[model samples]
Target: MKMTRIFVAALAALGLSGIAWASTAGQREAEHFHWHNAGPFGTFDREAVQRGLQIYQEVCSSCHSLDLIHFRNLGEAGGPFESAEFPNANDNAIVMQIAAGYMIEDGPDDAGDMFERPGVPSDAFPSPFANPQQARGSNGGALPPDLSLIIKARHHGQDYVHSLLLGFNEEVPADVHVAPGKHYNPYFPGGVIAMAPPLFEGSVTYADGTEATMEQMSEDIVTFLTWASDPHMEARKQMGVMVLLYLFIFAILVYIAYRQIWAKVKH
Candidate 1:
């Protein structure tokens, strides 16, 4: 059939493309992100997420932005944003800063200016770049992609990122030619991405009294990134339940309808 031929052609195309990526992506499974205890890996850890957010604010925010993520998402990780503002610099000064652009004032009137300055709310996280060009220039023209949805894009994302951070540099075969400013990594979309390893051994200090080893820090950051990308995990789960319930109900109705229509016309 025509449809069968089309399906075969599509499969062939997919195979060729995947092969091309394999040559370029050169990504390995062991050294890149492979979390032993995260949602996709094992289970979600609320405490690890909380710590990851703290680390993100202090360190990674300088380089990355969770523009699609809102300030309120912190609630899922046991941080309900105690105050009305974000990244609050002080107890009294409410104008919280972000890696992205400054927060534009927007809220209900008669709320009576709770803080000295306006804040970024849970509905939004600002973009650091004025535009895409500026963003590319800032990061050696690599164009730091918005990380708010990175977890969804990455393969075994949490694990891959964690592994990369834990010094999972790749071995370029002696015959392969690697251009300058490009690092060979098996975990990147292109086996040779411009992104150098971001995390290193003992790169951060933990307030939870945990050792700031490469493994711990990488895992923590990945957790935060995952939550940032998918803040509504609980909501999504709820919706899934509703969907399943609706399907069950619909099936029952259809069965009843079928029985009634055929009952009077017994063959």
Candidate 2:
């Protein structure tokens, strides 16, 4: 009898927890957006990726860190800044120029002291905050996640990121209570986010003269991040296609040989 009562109480508690979770966990589904790199034959749009890089430098870099990326990656084949003339990423002048813009920290000389130096193609991107504690302290106790693999990290990653960027709602729903320093985004779980709306119109003047609309910026940044997450996607897809074609031809040849060998021996 005691075991039965305990079971019943536990079930009731679970039911109440489920109900509470259902109430607060209503998040809008991410809207789908057509990507240039969606299909097997798809390739990333270089222009959009370049623009996205600009957006990251101008805005996102202030909070988020792309810890996994290096400046040399920009000059690699199929990268946003790839140039036919520069076969080696380290030797690419444009990449070198971009790297030079950032200051990097280097280690101890004979004097045994750390020092700052100009960034190089081989250097990993610098974090805006020195540590996690500093990052959290600046952003109301929320650490801005590294954007390096963000596209691959989230569910429905591409769409979710794009929608979340555009999903911030100024008019809060009556039932939802937004806490101090938090913003309402329907796409975010629990419908609340610590990072406020980051993109705005005219956030950055595009060098290529593209209008910096909120939607455009969101799409561009997502594209850049997608590339960052999978820099070798195009090469991988190409290899897959070649392998499939080779297998198909090999299978056909084997079938032909089998038919020839069994011509006189009928089962």
Candidate 3:
């Protein structure tokens, strides 16, 4: 009973550091933010969102909450991920699957008696505690934030996520309190955040045998957050491509028109 209580207390403490704290990605060191320089999947695989999603589920999701997103949106992030398995994800179903970890009450809705989480699209995932005060009292006053649009709302978008994931460093003083865990960065929008550095060098062992270095993991996770920030990435990419195609066609027509108009003149 004692051990069970301790474990429960620990989780409750972690939960107390409720979601709401966020650090801007671009706010980190200039070099690290270069993850943006990696370019799109064509330039560098931004599609690692699956990999990043895996990282978020394995590490960050336990404490943070993406209350705004539904489990079904993962696979739909890009045109479907090519592989059947993501390193951290058991099956391709990771996208549509909900976290089975904690369950809380969400009050009555259309279903009448109330619903359970990770609830279907029809339900909202319940918080670990009834309210923020409960969370803060246990968590040393930290609150996690909704991660749905973090990438978009912040500057440099995806680049920022990449930098922040790998940027946690205790030696930097800003992150001293996090020790082996969370850290602080002067660049984070709020100037301080409760999240510890969840990813570290060789922290996770991938099933497919990729190096588990911090940089790789950071890149992967940022990709996922980028997608989560905008579930319609594929739609945006398609729109960009169409716009470029239209501009190219328009340019050709304009050139033709110019030649016709200038045909009678010679220099």
Candidate 1 residue lDDT tens string, 129-193: 76888878887778877778787676656666676666445677675566887777655654667
User: Residue 67 lDDT in model 1?
Assistant: 78
Please provide, for model 3 over 1-267, each residue's C-alpha lDDT reduced to its tens digit, 9 standing for 90 to 100: 864564444433322222444544435443445543232222225446556666776777666667776544443434235334553232335433553444646669876887655434233334454566766665667876667788766665565566666555634554334344345765565445666667878776665577878888887777666666665644544555555556568779999999999997988
Kindly report which residue stretches of model 3 are placed more than 4 angstroms away from their true locations once superposed.
Answer: 1-28, 32-47, 77-112, 115-131, 170-186, 189-192, 254-267
| Winner on lDDT (1 vs 3) | 1
TM-score to native of every candidate shown: 0.63, 0.89, 0.62
Error of 3 at 53 (Å): 1.9
Q: Global lDDT of each model?
A: 0.59, 0.86, 0.57
Give the clash total for candidate 3: 18
Residue 154 of candidate 2: its Cα lDDT? 79
Q: Over the stretch 1-267, how does candidate 2's per-residue lDDT look in tens digits?
A: 864564444433222212212322587878899999886677899999999999999999999999999999999988998998999999999899999999998998789999999999999889999999999999999999999999977777799899999988557899999998999999998889999899888999999999889889999999999999988778766765665566568779999999999997968
lDDT measured at residue 184 in model 2 versus the true structure, 0 to 100: 96
Ten-residue region with minimum lDDT total, candidate 2: 14-23
Clashing pairs in 2: none
Q: Could you give me the TM-score of model 1 versus the true structure?
A: 0.63
Estimate the overall C-alpha local distance difference test score of candidate 2: 0.86
